[model samples]
Every structure is written in structure tokens, then in C-alpha cells.
Target chain A: MSATQSRPEPKQDEVYSALASARRPKPPGRLSMCLTFGWRGMLKIKHVPEQLIDVTLTPVLFLLMFTYLFGGALAGSTSEYLQYLLPGMLVQSVLFTSVYSGVALNADSTKGVIDRFRSMPVWRPAPLAGAVLGDSVRYLVAAVVVVVLGLIMGFDPGSVTGVVAAIALIVVFSFALSWIFTTVGLLLRAPQAVMNAGFMGLFPLIFLSNIFVDPATLPGWLEAFVHVNPVSHLTTATRGLMGDGASAWEIGRVLLEAAALAAIFAPLTVRLYRKAS
Target chain B: MSAQLAIEAVGLVKTFGATRAVDGVDLAVPRGAVYGVLGPNGAGKTTTIRMLATLLRPDAGSAKVLGRDVVAQADEVRSLVSLTGQLASVDEDLTGRENLVLLARLLGFTRADAKARADELLEAFGLADAAGRQVKNFSGGMRRRLDIAASIVVTPELMFLDEPTTGLDPRSRNQVWDIVRALVAQGTTVLLCTQYLDEADQLAERIAVIDRGRVIAEGTPAQLKASVGQGALHVRLLDADRRDEAEQLLARALDAQVHLEPDPARLTVPVTDAGRATGAIAELSAAGIELADFALGQPSLDEVFLALTGHPAEETVDEEEAA
Candidate 1:
């Protein structure tokens, strides 16, 4: 619009092209712009597996290393530690993996790929949407792979419905979270900045909660914050279903918290998403 | 499809802080003509195109494209035009066919329509055999052809090509020339921005030569050449400094109104007569002046550019973009 003419005399399309005028595409007929973008992501993944490696290996290693060394000090036994650590690892893996959305997006924007897309008549949200969907697969895959490996390593799953339901919730949260990080990526040009900011956030959130330790061990105020913490809800629900002696109300509470966060985070993230591009 | 005004840019000024990139240039490009904007780097050719492409904001200006106000009617303007930039802007990961089809689908074509259009473009651009090859591996020419092909899939009546053949080989450049000719044959209007004078000569119907952010000279290619000087001449100097001295002697020895480019190593003069160059060489040598290389031909856009801009097109767009 900086150059779209504002003259009183209206010009038709052909006249505009001759004059070397620039016009954007509107409601173009292609239904697969998002898929095309997704395909591009898949193509990029072929050239580099490092992106998925962090998602794939980071959670498994974090759980194994944290549980083996600190399990005694935190939970008094390795087995009890495994039960507590696995569920929170699920949420953490998804949240952490989503930060790549910001990194990859920033790289693409700086390279002028975003500018190229903006000039096209493709769907406005296709690039962001496709990338989110494509990358969410890694989060889902990582969570599942880590859990299956954890089970083989002697972590127990008590109820089939509970395990599947827990996994499904984490997937949705990760996708929602991707919307958030992607917005940040669009706003920032540097990927390293996004990674550092995401990591600095991750350390405290994981450290302050009952991800490994019993919540009863925390001080009163800190414990109160943990009681309502989103990670706590998911951990309690997963622990309860794993036969750690939680009540049905614990399951209800987790579902309610997850629903509330989804409701709160989704719309805010979407408005940010629109503005980022 | 026949709009009264194809483009209207009034008081279009785009500045970046202390630098006024496009310092209030006005332009009107009507339907079905190739309007070429020629300039050296930092002269705001690309910046002006960016404003027209709606990729940047104007500090103070208003434009309308195909009857839509740039800011107020951006989406409407977006619906009708296409731009092919200096570098090939196609996705490198996709195959030529996939790139075209994906763009077609995004542009609202049905699956069948998209495939059909993609196939047509592939054949048209001589990429049918390479349609399945990933674009990242493509030659410069192939990628440029694909870029233009992807943009024109919708048969946009308005196209903005900013230095479309900047780094292409001669064969690839000619391929684009054919494509531009084909588009014009179909009544599509093109606004071409290029540093290549010969390209403007071959493709543009009217030329707008910009220098230091203003239209210093404009007209048909022939008219611009006439504005600077008429025919061409060569000066032979035996030594380098004498080359400089010979330039001064020739400026006065032939036509008194002639202007000599500062560097006589590659000098151009207006007078066409062959004997005047020979006579000047004899007089300069007798007067103890020496020379190196000299030749005579028709007046070139290079001379016209130097004469009008007071500087050679020393600034390349690529180096400016790096900044």
C-alpha cells in the first residue's frame, strides 16, 4: 500500500500491470497452500535431522538422568520417581520442542521467504499453519517415543484410557503452544535469541514444580502456586491413573485445568499469530 | 479487463531514517505497455518496486492499482497483480511442477485446474523434462523461468519484474525476453526495472531513466540516446595519461558541445563522422599525445546513462541489497 496509487481515476488490472504496478493476490483458488507449506517443511527436514533430534532425544535423556541421580533425594525410590517424572516429561517435551517454531520461522523471515509468500495470493495463514502442523508431528512423536521407551525401562502404565487421554492432552497443548512461539518467531529475526529465551523460561517452570519431588515437601506459598500449576494438574492426573492413589476428582481437576488453559491461550495466540506475519 | 488507469502513484515517497530511498517520485503506467524504470543502485528502483508490491510502507504517498487504493483497498489490489523479483523467488525444495501446482492451488485453482496450469507452464518454460527435479538443483535460467511461470499462472494482467534476469546467462536472458514478449502479445502490461540498458532497449516501449532518485531522462530508448548525444567515435592514444589528454583534445577538436567521460580508458563521444576521429588522432599524436584502444559504433545506452546521470551506473543492485 505504500505505493498502491490513490488517484481519483480508477485503473483496471491490465493498466496496472503495464505501469509495473504491484498487486497482491486475494482468495486465490488453491486449497492446498497450507499443505504446500507443510510439504516444504517436510522437504527441509530431509536436509536436516538436527531439528527433530533435540525433540527426540532431549526428553528421554532429561527423564533418565534426572530420575536416576536425584530420585533418592526427591522421592526416596527410583520406581516412584519414574511414575512422577514421566508425565511432566511429556508436557515439557512438547513445550520445549515448540520453541523450534520460533527459530525456524525467524530464519525463514530473514531470508525473504516470508516476503515471497506475502506477495503470493495464497492463504494468509498457510505458512504459519503448515509449519505448526508439520513440526507438531515431531512433538507428538517425541512424547510417544519417550513414553514407550520409559515403559520398557520399567516405568508403569496402569490404565490404557488414562495413558492415551494424557498423551492426547499434551499434543493439543503443544499445538496451542506452537501458535504462541510462532508468533514470537515472526516478531523476532534471530533464532538464537528465541532459543535462549525459551530455555531460560523452561528451567524455572520445571524446577519449581513437583515434576520429581512430592508437592508436600515445598514451602506453603510455593506449594500453593504448584497446586494450581498446569503441569501439576497433568502430573497429578497421570500419577493418579498410574495407581499412585489419586482420587477421581484429581482426574476431573486435570481435565478442567487443561480445558481452561486451552480456552485462554488459543485466542490470544491466534491474534498474535495474525499480527506476526 | 480494460481499466482506464492501470496504475497511479502520486507523491510516493519511501524513506528509511536519514536516507530518502524513494524521494517523492510520481508514476502512472497505463494498460498493455512495458514501462521500464532504469537506474543505478540506491537510486530507489527496487524500493519503488517494493512500494508498488505493497511490501513496504510509504512515508507520504498514495497509490492505486486497478482502481483500488493501496492502503484502503490493499486486498483488492493484491488480487490482480504479480511480481517476479531480481532473484528467483521460487521455493527451492519443491519440484518445478510442484512449485507451480502449489502456487496455482493457493491462487484458488481447483486440483484439476492447478495440475493443468502447472503442466502448461512447465511446457511453456521448457521445463517439462525437469519438472520432477528439485528446484534447488536447477540452473539460474531454469529457476528464473520457473519463478516467472509460477507468478503468471493466474494470467495476471499486471506484472512487476524487478531485474528478472540480473544474473542469468545470455540464453536464459533470451528465454525471459521471449516470455515477456509472449505476455505482451496477450495484452498483459509489464513494469520492468533493470540496470541492463540493452534489455530496456529490446523490451521496453518507454524508458524512465532514474538517477539519484529522480527521472533525469525518459522517453523511448532512441529518444533518450538522442537526449545525450548522436553517433559514436573512438580515440587512439599511445599512452595512458595521453589518453586523458586526447579526450580533452577530442572534446574540442571535433564538436565544441561534446562532453568527455572522465575515464578515457573507456570513452564515448557524440560525433558520428569517422574522419573526425582519425583527424583528431593524427593531430593529438603530432601534438605529442599517445593512445591505447579506440573504436566507433552507434551511440549506446551506456553513454546516454553516463551523460545523463553524470556518473556511470557504478552501483550494482546486489551490492546495495547486501547493505
Candidate 2:
């Protein structure tokens, strides 16, 4: 051996500086962060099964209420209208369920759960990313259960495969939406105020979308507003995927719109979450 | 021979708006010695420990734990040190064994190693029987034991305990003391922050008495006690209105100077131990000084704390002060 010695090779962990990395580590093939967080959230659900009372009943109730109350004026036949409204109701229920992201974060803080985690040596982002990953499961299951129930009640859209695609699309969009509120939850000091903001700001976003009526059927200005709405794109995408005849362009626009929503809100929520207490 | 320094902090400062939680301060702890930060609540002891533990950033100065810079090498420092904060709790949903096992996993132990560590800690902390019981059912002392055990799952080289016995009952406090001694025996350097002087006296190799974010006095317990002893006796008068009569009489009788309150019944004369105490009492009685109760004393840490704060030794701890 030579008298002079060179530096030793760096370990796998030294591959990248965490500070320099733009995104958090998703280490290849260990435990996908998605599963770890997903498991934790699922455990909480098993303990408090009562949380399901809303997701199971809300969509069915809303579909019936609208089909019976406003279906005559809107669509003439209640059956034809549900095929249209059920797709939108699926989107609404998934979106509404996403608000729990903030509620869960707030509860953890109030209960000193987050403080306990802070003292522990786990990855700072793991608990957060895990919560999001876990909630995806809840949203996906809710979307599927609601649609399966709708299918049994003669709310047929098209092929089984096509209906599956629509549910999958709604699940992806809802996961993206929940991250936005998770950040909102992180920034808002109190869960009560955050829930109030949801009731106020979120209520309008849901109603203003094309969930209740077709954009062309509305007043000219309102139709223009509805046509440009991102939620409209999601609703349109879901309706197309579930319907018998929908073009590639219609599906493409839905995906493109969904991507744009993710682009705008994903980074905004990350920034808000970092600044959260 | 140079002893390894477990912790070194200098000019560390942190300000929350206008209030300086930890003002400019310096700390040095030798490896394998128990160092105590003795102070009342809000004297910046907890903030100082937080900065050292790498949980809170300091606005100024720097710290090194096991030669790792706290800010620059925080992860490395964290790996070497474990902190049991006052607010920590065992996971209420998880069994006590699971809590320790989970901590072991986070510290990079394998399943077998984690379980072994969990079992060892459970027995050490007297939680063997309650190991499988959910932490929610455990009493306050059992939870505290589990929390401390969890912090040391990796057998950290340096440990920080912040007021670990603040609200504990006497027996429970002794149980905590046993665990703390066991860690020190294993050569873990411990820096304990406590407002209770008795804890410092019992556990620390050296103590620093802090007040209003500054070190007012620091040394071994015996050294500090010696500094404030002036060979004196203190007598409390029974009647609040006892005026100058006692002081005048004792001064004339003792031939040594005597001082008393502006009251009539009390007088303090020079003294050392109980032998000198007997002589002073005999002199007081001979002089016809009507004393109610008299006790010979050297200043305790209580008096030392009162001296630094410029307030009476016995005053209600105002709620706002703790906040």
C-alpha cells in the first residue's frame, strides 16, 4: 500500500444533502412513505368508526334530495338527471371529506400529539406526508362505496371499467384537494376557525361548480364562469369517464385541468405548511 | 488528562419578541458528570436546554455536544443526545412496550434489538408488569418512566432531563432518581434542569443557580452553601410588634455584635454550629431578651435564591410568572 491515503467513499445516505433536496426523500423500496402514513391514518379510523356516518350517508342523501326537489325543473325526468348529478355528487363528497386533513392536524396539535412527535427523531415530513397518504385510502374507499351504492339503485353511467376510471379520477383529485386543506390546517391556529372557513369559502366553491346544472343551461355570464371553473373540468372529466360516449379530448382537458390545479395549489400548500405552527 | 466535554455553550441567546427566553449565556459540562441548571420557572433553563438539544435555534452563540456543532451537525448531535422534556408523554393508544419499541425503531434498531431494548427498559423502570398495558391506563409516574425510557432507547451518550420531578410524589421521584443513577453509571453525561434545589443537591455534581436569564451563582452544593455562611443565628419573633428591645439587650450581653429586626423580641448573634448556638441562647436568656423562638442557621439555597431575587424567600409563585 502507498504511504498516502485518499478519502473514504460516502455511504448511501450521504448521496444527497437533505437541505439541498427540493423535495423530501422517497427512499427507493424501503417502506414507501405512502404505506407508513396510510397505515397510521387507517388505525385511527378503526378506533373511531363513527367518522364514517357522514361519508356513507351524505352523497346518497344529496343525490336523492336534488333529484326529487329540483330534478323536475332542471331535467324533466329524475332518472336521466341522476346519471348526470351522481358523477358530480361523487366529486362533492370526496372534496368535502378532504377537509378532515386540517381537522386531524388541528386535533393532533391540541392533544399534544404533534409536540410528542417534535421531540422524536423521525423525519419531520414523514408524519405529514403519511397523513396525506393515509387519507387517500379513506377518500378512495368512500368514492368507491358511494358509487357502488349508486350503481345498485339504477344509477348506471356506462361500462364497469368506465365507472371505475371515473372513481379513480375523483380519488386523485380529492387527494390533491386535501393537501391544500392540510396546509390550510397547518396555517390556521384553531380547527374551529378553519372549519368555519371551509363552511364559508368551500360551500361557495361547491355550489358555483357545474355539480347541480349544465353550464349551457345557465345565464350567459354564469355559464361562462362555470365553463372556466376548475371544478367544472373535474366534474366534466368524471361525467365523461362514466358516460357511454366521451371523446379523448374531453378526458384530456379534465386531466390537464386537474394537473393545473395540482401545480397551483401543491407548492402553495407546502409553503403554508412549512410556515404552520 | 483532559476530560471529554459533553456539552459546551457560549453566548447563546434567543428572543421571543421583546422577551429574551435565553439571554446571552454560557454552559460547560464534562463527560460522565451530572450537571444541574437550578432556577425557578422562566429563568431560561428550559430554553437554554432546548437550544442545546437542537430543538430550538439560538439567535446568537453556538453549542457543541460530543464535538458536533448543534446547528451545523444537528442530526449527528441528535443521534448522540436524548432529551426528556417536561411535556413528553407515552403514546396513550400504544402499550408501554410498544412506545419504547417504536422509539427504538426510530433510532435505527432492528426488530430484535428494539424488542430487547424495550424489555430491558420496562424492567429497569419498574414497568415489567404493565409492559403490555396501554399507556392511557398507566399512572403519572409510570408514564414518566416510560417517557424517559423512550428517550434513551438508543442509549444516548448525552441526556437532557428538564424538571423531571417537578410534580412527582416523593416515592415516584425516588423511582426516577434510580433510573437517572443507572444512566450515569453507564457513563451517560446528564444535564438536569430543575427549580427544586433538593433535586440538584441529590443528583448533580455541580449546580448553576440561574435567575432572569443569567447565572447568578454556580458551584458544587457544598461550595455554594459555604459562601453564604457567616457564622450567624436567626431568630423569629412571635409577636409582629416586638421592637428594638431584644436587639439592645443581646448587644449589651454577648460582647459580640448582635443585629435584629425593628421588632422587640428578636436578635441575631454570631454563630457557627450547634455548640456556638448553645452559647448564644444562654447569652440571650441572661440578658433578659424575651425571645419567642430561636434557631441557629447558615444560609440555605432558599436564602441564596432570595438574595439573588431581592424578594422574600417565601412568596406565592404568581401564576403569570410560570406562564
Candidate 3:
């Protein structure tokens, strides 16, 4: 220990000077702080590229397996089913990816990183908003994966503008949907628990919707739920946008639902975030 | 006038469900010095620091950091103080440089400035070589250094270090102590929370001993030691069997109670007069109690805690079960 201690230590003085010379810069604007946190989220993904597996692989696998397994049984033909299933698959893929936002938030909370953020002078919601914003990239990636695989599998959308519009609508809905999971993330004690609850809630919503089959084929009681399900509305709106121009009413209704989810859950999430220990 | 104090709190309280984590705690920490809140695990040290740092709202009472109310002017307090939490608050998934850069950007530095500041901090903290590696791969000491570096990105007027050296090696702990000293030399007041008595004795100008959600004792290290006694004589017997006889003889010679240590072969006697310790040792030797070792030194904070609270300082308490 004495031998090591005898070595010249220049960094100690440098540390002192560094501390003495520090000048407080004007705090960044709320948007900049959010962007900085968003950058941090992206950096996490970059460092651990395996995080992209769920967003990329899950969508592609669902697209491949669902189109092949259910095409003849449900839609009467593979190519025909491809056109119908592609947009809905996009919706499922993006919505499934949204659960990760809450999971990541819960993980951050447990790890004490959120305490660091809370102690900072930055805008209170910047971390949550920034996480949702970062998850938007994952939503986009999942949307593209499903759509590009659909094009490869002989599904024809007929117009580039329609596909773009469909992808945009699903991403918007996913963004709004992320707030619900963020709320769950703050409420739950563990990331795994948040993930389990998110998937448990989403499974029924996605499976009962018109994503996989025609609602007309379902029993009356089940079909009633399929008709009113928000995910069903989102899938229908996405399918209409990709296949033909959607009605203003249909698009407007989906947008309204997204707005409503955001309005209700975003505030709730912020409140939970503020109170989270 | 209150501005001269780094922190002032009155009856600050925080409860989690049924547990009163911090109940009616008060603190007055003067500026530009390290003030230690010493306690074992789950002693409300973290909870109290959390409230002062504006991370947790006090259920009752009020705190002013740098003369700004923690609850009402929390943003101002946050801008003025930084908390390096008990947990390594830096993101483990990011590189050391990235963590510093992220904080610097959030603190309002431009792209170039953030990078420059991050690199400077990395270099100064001896993390320059590990800057590009993810923090999850860093050693415990490296991670702690980075956490402290993250706190001082903007040189907060007051910094809350909750158990800064809790699980660190002795060398790393000394490094952290040096950093704390350097920060104070640069005029940044530090609120250091630690379970290690020596850490508080080495760095803090004043110490507050907290237990069971309250401050049990507060003073300078010397004052706390003096309160326990002037000094103590610690003797280890070569044979554990003869310890009882030695304890009786030592108590008779020193005119003080002999404390049987858990070691079975060792006994501790608090002595106000150094002259009496020498006489007690002679009496022990005269009784044919073979001595393995003996030392006379000022009362350690452990003895101080024992004398003050009737329990050792390191006894683990489950006060933070709810937390």
C-alpha cells in the first residue's frame, strides 16, 4: 500500500481544480432536457442491441406465422390474407412494443436512476416523456418490419401514401398507448410485474379485436366486444388507410380515442411518477 | 441570515404506508463544510437526505436548502444541490462518458461544452480509460467515483452523498474522503451520510448520530468521543477462560465497569484518566491473566454509540422495510 501510495498523484489536484472551476450554466429548456433523456434512451439501445429483438423479431415472426397458419383457414387464401393481416399485424407489433416503455421505466425506478432525474432541476416529466419518445423509434421499427415483410410476401397496398398513412396512425396510437404502461410502470413495484400486467391486459385486447379474423364469424357476445374494442377501431382504421382511403369519421374516431387515452393516462402517469418512491 | 446555513429543517417527517420513516427530525448544517448523518442501515438517513434533496416530500414539517423551502421552491433547491444517492445513480447501461455527458447536457451545456466537461470529469476522476466502457462493467470504486462525478457536473452549492462509501474498499473509501475534502476546499458544502464512524470522524466538521428516525446525538467527533469518556483500554486475553478474573481485577483497579466484548477473549474498559489504564493493566498481569494484546486509545465512535445509545452503532435495524 505504501509503495502504491508513493506514486505521484496528479489527478487529485486536477479534481480540486475541476471542482473549483465549475460554473453553472443556465439550465436547458424543457424540450432540450427531454431530448437529452431521449438521447440516453437511444444510447441504452445502442449499447445493448439485443433490446431490439422484441421490436423486430416478434413482429416478423407474427407476420410470417399468422399469415401462413391462418390464411387458408381464416381468409381462404394466403395472398388474400396477407393484405388483410399486414396492417393489423403492424398494430399488434407496435402495441406490443409499447409495453416495454413501462417495463423500462419500472426498471429505471428500481435501479435508482429515476431518483437522480427527480433530483435534477430539469422538467419533471422530461424523463417519462423522453422514454415514450424514444419508444416511438421502436414503434417505427416494428411498423416497418411488418410492412416490409408484408410487401415481400405479395401483399399489395396499391399506394405508397396509404402505407405511410397507416404506419403513422399506428405509431400515434402506440404513443398514446404508451402512457397507460408508463402509469403501470410507476404503480408496479417490479419491471417483471409491470410487463406481466401489460401483456395480460394487451393479450385480450389484441386477440379479441378484428386483427386476426372477421368479427362477423365470431359469436354474438364476443363480437360485441370486438366491435367496441379500441384496438379493433385502431386496426380497422389502419386497414382502411392501407387498403383504401379511410372515412374521415373512422380516422377521426381513432384519433379521438388516442387523444382520450393520452389525456387520461398521461396526467395519471405524471402524478404516479411524482409520487413514486 | 438563514442563507448562511446550507440546510435548515424543523420537524421534518415522512411516512411510507404504516411506517414513519423520518419522524420529526431537525437539522441545522452550516455552510462550506461536510456535515455527517451517521447511522446504520435503515436508520432514516437515506429518507432524510431524500427529503432534503427534494426527491421526496415531507409529510409534515419544513426544510429550507440554501434558504429556499424544499417543498415550495424545490426547483431552486434542486438547481442548487445535487444528490449522489446510496445506490449508484449513474445509468449502468451507459458508458461512463455518456452518463456524464447526459447530465452535463441536462444541466444546460451545449454539445461541445457537454463533451468537454464530460471528458474533463472522466479524466479528473481517474475514469478516462474506462470512459468508453459501459458503467455496468466498472468496478465498485469506479462506479462510485462516476456517481460523485455525476453529482458535481455543475458543482452544486450543497451535495448530498448518502452512504458514499458504504461498500467500498478501504482505498476507494479514502479516495472518496479525499474527493469530499477537495469539494469542501472548493467551497461546496457536503451532507455526507455514512454507517462508518471513521469516515465521519475523518471528514465531517460535525456529526449527527441518528437512529430509529431521530437524531440521538450531534457534535464534532472529538466532542462525541469525549462525551463517551476520555479514552478506553482494550485488552485481549491469551486464554478466553481467564477473562472473567481479568475483568474483575481490571474493574477493581480502574474503578470502571469492564465491558465483555463479543470476542470472549477481549474486554473494554472506559477510563477517564490515562493513568488508571496503566494501573489496570498491571493488576491484570499480576493476576496471572496472560495478555495477548492491549491498547489504550481515545474512545472510537463505536464506543461513543454504545455509551450514548446502549447499543452498538452497526446493529442492523429494519426501519426501511417499507422503503
Task: Return the clash pairs for model 3, or none.
Answer: none
lDDT (Cα, tens digit) per residue for candidate 3, span A1-277: 1212233222888898788778989888999888888898899889988989978999888889998998988888988988888889999999999999999999999997889999999899999989888888888888888888888899888789988898899889999999999999988989999999999999999999999999999999999999999999999988998887799989999999999999999999999888777
* TM-score of the A-chain for all models: 0.78, 0.81, 0.95
Cα-based lDDT for every prediction: 0.71, 0.70, 0.88
In angstroms, the error of model 1 at B295 is 3.6
Writing each residue's lDDT as its tens digit, candidate 1 over A17-45 gives 42242222345433367776776677667
- Cα displacement (angstroms), candidate 3, residue B98, comes to 0.5
Off by over 4 Å in 1: A1-50, A218-277, B211-213, B230-236, B240-249, B256-291, B296-306, B309-323
**CA lDDT, candidate 3, residue B56:** 86
lDDT of 3 by residue, B28-114 (tens): 999999999988786799999999998889999999999999999999999999999988998999999999999999999999999
Best by TM-score: 3
Report residue B221 deviation for candidate 2 (angstroms): 2.6
> lDDT per residue, candidate 2, B123-155, as tens digits?
656677778776777766777777877766666
Docking class of 3: medium
TM-score of chain A of 3: 0.95
Q: Which scores higher on DockQ, 1 or 2? A: 1
- Regions more than 4 Å wrong, model 3: A1-10, B239-241, B262-264, B273-279, B296-302, B317-323
DockQ top scorer: 3
DockQ of each: 0.20, 0.09, 0.57
